[model samples]
Target: MKSWRTMSICLLTLFLTILMGCSFSQESGEATGSSIILEFSEIETITDAGVQLAYDDVHEVKKIDNSFMVYKKTASDSHLYLGSVRDKQLTEYGFVGEETYIQDFTKNEESLFGRPMTLITGICGANCVENYLFEQVDGQPQLILKLSGHVLVADLNEDGEKEVVMMQGSPQIEIHVYKRIGDQIMKVNLNEEIGLTNSVTYNSQTNVFEMIINNETKQYRYDTDSDSLISL
Candidate 1:
C-alpha cells in the first residue's frame, strides 16, 4: 500500500510539472505576440507644422537627423509624410502620393544628389512592384527616381556614390543597373541581361554585388567604362 501511494504521488507530480510548463509557455507566447502587435498598431502622435497628427496602424517610422518620416496604412490606401522638428517647431515637408498598396518604405544608406534619400515600394500586380526614390532636398522630399521590380541600392563601383540595382521577377528574371551621372539618373547598358536571379545584394567586404539564383551565387562588379556588370 505504501509503494502504491508513492507511485501515485510521483505520477501526480510529473503531471503537475508538465501542466505548469505548458501554462508558462502559453503565457510567454501571448506576451510576445501582444508586444509585437502593440509595437505596430499602437496609436502615435506627432506634430507636423504645428498641426497635431495622431495616427495608428503605423507601418514604419524613420528618423533622419531632425526630420521624421511616417508611413501609415488604412483599410484601402496608405500615406507617407515627412516632417521636421526645429527650434521647437514642427513643419511638414512632403507627402507621398495616394498609393493603394504600399508595401514598404525604407531609407537608403547612401545619399543621392548629395542628399539623403528614401524609397517607397508599392505593389501593382501579382508579381510587379514599383519603387519610388525620394531625396530630401532643401527641407523637402523630392521624388528623384522611380523603377519597377525589386530594387537594391549600394555603391557598387566604390565611387563614393550609390548605384541602384533592379531585379524584375515577372515573365522572367531580368537585372538592370542604374547610375547617376551629373544631374541625370541613367540606366547602365549591360548589353545583356544578367539572366535569372532570385535576389541581389551588395557585398561590402568584396566591394561588389552578389546575385543569387537557384541556390547559386554570382558576384559582379560595375564597369564604369563599359557601363555594365562584369561577372566575377
Candidate 2:
C-alpha cells in the first residue's frame, strides 16, 4: 500500500509538469503567429486542369490582399470546388457557383447555409480580406472571402469602380468591396446592409447601391463613406 501511494504521487507530479510545460510553450510560440499550408504528395500532381486554373485565379487574387466567396457546385449532381491561394499557399478557400462546407481555423467551427460566394478584390486594409463557406438556397455549399470596410474604400479611390466587400457572421455584416483594373483589383467598402424586399437594382447616381429583403417591396440605401445607411 505505501509503495503504490508513492508511485501515484510521482506520476501525478510528472503529469502536472508536462501540462505546465506545454502551456508555457504554446503561449510563447503564439508570438510567431501560425501558418496554414496545403500538403500534397511529392510524386502527385493536380489531375483536373480546370480545377487547377480556378485555384490559380483565386490564388492570384489573394496575393493582392483580396478576399473570395466561393461555392461548390452541388446542383444537379455536379461537383465543383474553388479556393484562393497567396504566394503558393492556401490563404482563402471557397466554392464557385454552388454551396460548400467552410472550416474556420480562428474559431475552429463549421456552419451550414452560407451565401453565394464572390471574389472581393482591391480591399486595402491589412488583414482585411477574409475567407468563408457558402450554402445556397438549393441545398448546396460554397466558400466565401471578405474584406473590411477600411480596406474597401481605400483601394477603390478615384476609379469609377464598383466596390467589393467582406463581412462576418451568418447574416454578413461589415462588408468590404473590391474592383479590378487591368490586373489588380481596386477595393472599397459597401457597408450598411441594404434593406428591401427580395431583389433590387442599383443605379449609378442617386443610389450607388440597392438591396431588398426576402420578397418585400421596401428598398433601402447603402452608404459607403461612413459605413451606415443613407436611406431606407
Candidate 3:
C-alpha cells in the first residue's frame, strides 16, 4: 500500500508540473507582446504567367496587411483564398470541397502564431456549416481548426487572444471552445450541465458570452490565466 501510494503521488506531481510548464510558456508569450507578422514572409512578387489570378475572380476581398489580402468567392459554393493583388497570385486556403459558401469573416486585433488571426465560417457539401480559425504558420496560411456546426469567435476570457466557440451535433446544444496558446491550439473544457439555446450572444459592453434556451440563460467568462471558462 505504501509503494502504490508513493507511485501515485509521483505521477500526480509530474502531471501538475507539465501542466504548469505549458501555462508558463503561454503567459510568457502574452507578456512579450508577440507579433503575428513574424511567422510569415512577404510573398515573392511573381511575373504574370501561370499564377491563378484570384484578385479579379473573388467576390469580396479583405486586407490582411498592406501586402496580402483574403478573398472570398460566393456562388453555388464558397471558397477562400490568400492572395496578392500586386503579385497577381493567390493560394487557396480554406473551405474547399463541394458546394461551399463563405458565411462571415472576423479579424482579431491581436496576433496568433506571430501573424494576424482570422475567423471564417462557411457551408460546404450539402449545406454543412463549417468554421475555421486561420493564421500564418511557418510562412504559410494554416487552418488551426475546422469544425462543423454553429460557431462564434470572440475574446471569451477578455484575454488579448480570441477563442473559437463551436456548436456541434443536433439541436446545436453541444458546445466546444478552442484557445490558442503559444504555438499550440487546444480545446478547453466547458460546463455541460448548462445547455445552449438557439441563440448564443456576446455583449461587448460586459465582455460576457451568454447562451439562452427557453427562459433559462447561462453566462460565462473566460479565465485567461488558466485558459478555461468560468460561469458568471
Per-prediction TM-score to the true structure, in the order listed: 0.44, 0.23, 0.44
Evaluate model 3: give its lDDT. 0.52
Best by lDDT: 1
lDDT of 1 by residue, 1-232 (tens): 9999999999999999999999997755432221111111111232222343443333444444445544444444455554444444444434543345333444444575355677665555567666656676776555566566777666776767776767776544555667666666666323133333244555556767565534667566666655545666
Instruction: Give the winner by lDDT: 1 or 2.
Output: 1
Off by over 4 Å in 3: 1-114, 125-127, 189-206, 209-217
**What lDDT score belongs to each candidate, Candidate 1 first?**
0.54, 0.34, 0.52
TM-score-better candidate, 2 vs 3 = 3
TM-score winner, 1 or 2: 1
Residue lDDT tens for model 3, 84-162: 3455556554443232333343334435434476655555544456554566676554555556666665666555665
Q: What is the lDDT of candidate 2?
A: 0.34
lDDT of 2 by residue, 79-168 (tens): 233444334434233332211212211221222112123333221123333333233334332332232222222222323444433333
Clashing pairs in 1: 49-90
Ranking by lDDT: 1, 3, 2
Q: What lDDT score is found at residue 169 in candidate 1?
A: 61
Worst 10 residues of 3 by lDDT: 32-41
